[model samples]
Target: MLRWVILAVVVVVLAAGSTLLMNLSTSPGTSWNLPVTPAKAGPMPKAVVEGELTHEFGEMGQQQTGKKSWKLTNEGDADLQIWKGTSTCMCTVAKLQKEGDKLTLKPGESTDIDIEWKTNFVTGDFHKGANIETNDPDHPTFPLFVHGKINPPVVVIPGDTIDLGAINSDEPKTVFVAVYSPDRPETKITEINTSKPDYFKTDVESMSASELESGGLKAGNKINLHVQPGFPLGTMREEIVIHTDHPLRPEIKLTVVGSVSGPISVVPDRLRMVTVKSKEGASGEVRLLVRGGKEAHFDVAQKPEKLEVSVEPIDPVGAKGRYLMKVSVPKGTAPGLIDGEILLKSDLPGVAELKVPVSFLVGAN
Candidate 1:
């Protein structure tokens, strides 16, 4: 009876150990060979605008500010990243509710973008634009536009720039501009000034009713600009400032852009010494003339080396000032280029100095 009892206990112990080992090796929660699940990708970002891309502000006035708003919506599954971009001009700017340059929008999110600009003294139609950069593949760059006409209290016909064209320094140039206040016609010219006092002078006259009617002005003045002959040679970019008694339009600047030709001039502006044999050398000449039959005294300075220069007065033909300048490079010169210039200094004001570039290229024999 003792042996049978012992054997039954041993068999029960062996069965319990085998069940525990099976559970440890093959449990669903602790499996060693389970398969890995792949991750699914989310949707891309989408940008949608609710209204038109352009805004019309009608007619705006000077010193006034204009503002427009646009709704930007993100119709996507993933987050939308938008970067702020530059506006059309410095006077115009775009702003958002947030302070940072980068803004994120979740799915089905929307925000407002505001564009503000100030009306300057310029007249006529104006168009401004701003850009919005987005991560959306379909819509990389979104453009917004604002356009309108600007009406100032004071009106200048033919715009703010007065082109004098080509001006001869020996003769005076005159141009006319009509300045008037459409609403307040009785605006008087209080004072006048200019950037170049020696070259610019101004005169104003009241516009006749018929004259005003022709120009579509209610009341204003016809400004006469008498540009004297003392302006320097080359190019002149000057300004004329006018002061009015009207409170709304007190001052306005008129730009004068022109090219002035002095009494002294030159032909074949640049002397081409070109390529020549080192043994043969090269030679050239330039014809110099003073317009209006005016006599000039020029002293040549800063002449290049390995060259000879001579200035001789030509025979007077029809009361014209003319001269012959001769430049010569002697034979047996080195195989190199002579890099220098001849600066002609004049005794007349405004015609101070003239530069002539010398390109003396020499080839080996």
Candidate 2:
């Protein structure tokens, strides 16, 4: 009975030892402890943009200055970080407060992003944009827009220039331009002035509300400009200045363009006497033609020295205002280049005086 009980105890002890060695071999000397719950999941970071996302710079003119701003708020449980910002145009600038690359904003906190644009680089209508990079998962990037049309404070209708097309010097021509400011309604045109008052004259009248509304002018005045290309004509270019009540833009400048056509134009307006001898001078003749084959009355203003001028009516009376002007350069004239002008008076009201240039190059005799 003692041997049997000893044998059973030895068997149980050996079994328990074998089970412990098997567990150690499988786990390689590892130990087990109480299970740990994972840390509670937290809310993610987010951003809420407020204020203006887009701005309009109305009627921005040359070198005009303006600015716009927007607010950025951190509405998340974690910190809001603004990484950087970029602009589409070098003319536009974006600004923000510095907090390193990790610009931090606590919950419910906000910051401003200032954007400025100058009209010096743009004309007519323009549009621009900017992007702000942030850490917010919802909005990793924020976008902004800027747009508007450009016009000077003293704005001109039909544009900043007047193209009068082709005009005859023998007839009076007039152009109407509306000068006003849609951007500045309070301003008024104080005085209308022209650079060439003789050639380009201006008359102003109070623009009625109906006229203003019809012409799309919110406020300002209208100018009735009279242009007379005068004699000795070709392409004409002039300028008209407008004085305003505004302090900043006290004067507005505009271009005037036109071409002068003559009623009785000469074939060769300039008489060239190239390579002439001292004893025997050069002579030239010019034919005058009327615009519509009508009669034209003209008389010489002053007879040039060392030259004889005569006019003969066209033969057979086939054409009116058609005449032959014969210019005779006398002999024994001094050698050298001779620069002179032929003056003539006409019955035409628009063309009071006409000047024809004469150039003589007398060779050494």
What are the per-model C-alpha RMSD values against the true structure?
15.8, 14.2
State the displacement of the C-alpha of residue 10, model 2, in Å, after optimal TM-score superposition. Answer: 60
Off by over 4 Å in 2: 1-43, 56-67, 89-102, 116-121, 166-171, 190-196, 227-236, 245-249, 259-263, 266-286, 290-350, 354-365
| True lDDT of residue 124, candidate 2 | 81
lDDT of 2 by residue, 1-34 (tens): 9999999999999999999988886886587686
TM-score of each model, in listed order: 0.41, 0.58
Pairs with backbone N, CA or C atoms under 3 Å apart (clashes), candidate 2 = none
Error of 2 at 335 (Å): 23
* Model 1 worst lDDT window (10 residues): 90-99
User: What are the runs in model 1 whose C-alpha is more than 4 Å off?
Assistant: 1-60, 63-149, 246-249, 267-288, 291-295, 298-365
